[model samples]
Target chain A: MAKILDGKEVAAALKDELVAEVDRLRKQGITPGLCLVMAGSRPDSQSYINSAVKRCSSIGIDCRVKKLPEDVTQGDFLKIIDDLNTDPKINGIMVMRPLPQYISENTIKYKISPEKDVDCLNPINVSKVISGDDDGFAPCTPAAVIEILDYYGIKVEGKRTVVIGRSMVVGRPLAMMLLARNATVTICHTRTRNLAEETKKGEILIAAAGKAKMVTKDMVSNGAVVIDVGINFDESGKMCGDVDFDSVCPIASSITPVPGGVGAVTSTVLAKHVIEALKLQKGIY
Target chain B: MAKILDGKEVAAALKDELVAEVDRLRKQGITPGLCLVMAGSRPDSQSYINSAVKRCSSIGIDCRVKKLPEDVTQGDFLKIIDDLNTDPKINGIMVMRPLPQYISENTIKYKISPEKDVDCLNPINVSKVISGDDDGFAPCTPAAVIEILDYYGIKVEGKRTVVIGRSMVVGRPLAMMLLARNATVTICHTRTRNLAEETKKGEILIAAAGKAKMVTKDMVSNGAVVIDVGINFDESGKMCGDVDFDSVCPIASSITPVPGGVGAVTSTVLAKHVIEALKLQKGIY
Candidate 1:
């Protein structure tokens, strides 16, 4: 059996550290606060919100969920973001995706000040990620990938890593982050002419293509580290990953499973970013 | 002999178009203006400033040069930036890099207002480039590469593109731009395990890596579109590029020469970005 890179174990360890940090901050008269701005009623968003809130409470961090109605106007939404920006106590702000049909993400991204943008969804923070600078926070999902690698002792430096996706949130930023860590990263997408040929080169392959079972054994090399960032429904209606775990485990050295893998570590990273954001904003770092 | 992508010709043609636009803006009582901020006495920046000034004059755009003393304090330098940022008449602001030893790039990058950041140096503008949104402007060198390719009718969509280098100014932004154009972009850098092995996969190869003559004939595939963004000096004290001109040119279907290639197109693109910034600031875009 291949080494299942366990996210549950890593996340638990990370939570313990966060608890200590949260307590330390509380002693210094700082209470890290995260505001979750959710628009419309995405069932998935609600579940995600619940999980995030739970994680915040576990770490002794304050969590505020701002639920905006689906019919909220653009002006009203901007006003909400403005209030959050001025609220000195708020350390981090994360607006959930798949926002109301009328509100464009492009316009909304600027409203959330980069200082409070823990998710790194704000464009300035996005640019900072590309620059390999200290000012901006890394997006939570991509940061989770790094956390998982650090926990597993996987060497990203000088590795032939292939990222399967070109998303700004996952694939693009992750590639830059890996490069900052000294990895030679390649970004492959749906338009890639030879997906398997390209992916076979990866010593460390990250699948964020959002396609379930898309990566079979043939696509992976022997004993390569694989991370499944995709959350998809299989034919049996079960949540599976981009990599077919059963098929790939035999061929891979180590891999992250669907639910308990990257998904487990993402929210914890969000909390970590909140803490980091708080420190930077408060001139603690 | 490989077809040399003539950047000088493309730039000249672009100049003619910009002239017409500048006149149009003038008729509307908005003179398209660009303020070049040069700190210290770097010879390279001086020459670049001269060439940029000449380019602006030829295109009928207003160009102002703000030359600061090498020993100027960080506060004084930032004050100059603030003046330019608020100056409604100034359409674009170009800060010559390699600022004095004391000033940080991160601090200066933010000092330039995003609205007038013609080079896309501002973090918000940088993020906007990644977002592929309506507001942000693309940096000049990357924009030059695209312009050269578009002018030559080389297809980027669905192409296997390889970029050597990961500088925030060129390689990183170029990859995002290519990705936005639907290219399967891979970013390789100093730590890449097998640099040539990865670069060989590109149908379109871009050399922004600063190493002189690093890319040889073997690194490129036959008849590939090559764009070189390197400007270095050879042993003879003559200017050269990352790609070995004599060696790689024969194998490449199209390639840009160091002196007349990306360099010629860069300043024109910078001017074009200024016009864009002007339009955006005036609510004309």
Candidate 2:
């Protein structure tokens, strides 16, 4: 069996660092705070809220959840987002996505203040990431992936990395991030021919296909480090990753598990972003 | 002899379409307008300006030249950009780069309105590009290259595209644009090992290395389409491109000449952007 990349342990370490940072800021009369705006109470949104709130509590940072009914007007949603954006104590703002089909995500996204855009979903933040401007934050998940690799002493510089998806949330931005680190990155999607051949060439493989077990044992090379960003459901209704974990784990040099891997690091990265936002708000940066 | 891509011919066709569009917009009481902001009297800058003015005149759009001294302040440049942004006649704003070293580029970039950001150099516009939201203009040269290929009905879907260099103006954004078109894109920089090996895999090779005669005969696949974005000077003083034209042109299926290829189509795209920007201003789109 290969060495299991324990994401839960890594996340805990990150959270500890964030907690220490928060404490230091508290001494400086600054409280790192995050505001989550949930337009409708979907079960998945509620679950995420619970986990995020719990993490905030453990880190001793202020976490506020604003729940709007399903029938909330676009005007009302904007009002809540605007309030969080101006709230001097609120350092980060996250709007739980997949809002009512009628509501426009683009409208909400452009309205978020770039300084408080902790998720880095706003166009201004995304642009800053692309330009290497460093004025804004990268999305929590992609940022966590880079931080995880760096924390473990993995060198991305000049490595051949293959990202198996092209999503705004993960794959596309991850490729840009890897390229910024001097990696020779290849981004393959559904249109790509012979996906396995491409995956086998990766010194590092990042699977974010959103489909359960899309990457199998034959796709990865021996001694490759795999980062699984997909959270999916199996036939038995069990939460899983896009990687065929049981089959590929034995062949891989290192791998992150589904629930414990990227998912765990996300909330902590949000907390870190809050601290960073507070620093910016105070003009410390 | 292989059929050269004939970018000049392709660009002429596109200009014809643009002329019709400009006429239609003019009939609707919106004359397309472009404001060229040149910071200095550099010979290269003046040459580009003269050609752009000529294109705008031929396309039935109002072209205005805003020339400033090399020692102009960031504030003065921004004030001019703001004035143009507010002007009813000026629909697109392009600030030529390589401003005085004392002036901060970022300061001027942020001042240009996203709606009139025809150059797409500003962070706001860059962010829009990253999000795949065409809210603002794309930089002229890259957009021109894409339009040239699209005009020829060349297929980008599933093709292996190798882009040399990573300049934000060309290589980086162009790579993203190609990926958006479903091409399996690889971006190689100075740090990449075996540059020729990477170049050989490209079904479509984009050379933007800013180094004259970098892509030699041995580095290309037979019958590949080549788009050279470089405008570097050869050893004897004449302008050349990243591709070693003499050696590779005979073997390649299609190629763009440095002076008349991508550069020739650039201003026409800027004119197109002006029309688009007017539409945005009028809420037509």
> Which is the leading candidate under DockQ?
1
In the order shown, what is each candidate's alpha-carbon RMSD?
A: 1.7, 1.6
TM-score of chain A of 2: 0.97
Q: How do the residues B125-195 of candidate 1 rate in per-residue lDDT, one tens digit apiece?
A: 88878767657778899999999998888888878899999888899889889988888888888988788
Cα lDDT tens digits, model 2, B1-285, are 445666678778878988998888878877878888898788888888898899888999898999999888877877898899899888888887777765788788878888888889778788666656667677888898898789778888888888998888998888888888888888888888778988888889999989999999999999898999999999899998899999998988888888788887887887788878888988885
- Using Cα atoms, each model's DockQ against the true complex is 0.74, 0.73
What's model 2's TM-score? 0.97
Interface DockQ of candidate 1: 0.74
lDDT of model 2 at position B185: 85
Question: Lowest summed-lDDT stretch of 10 residues in model 2 chain B?
Answer: B1-10
Q: Candidate 1, which CAPRI tier?
A: medium
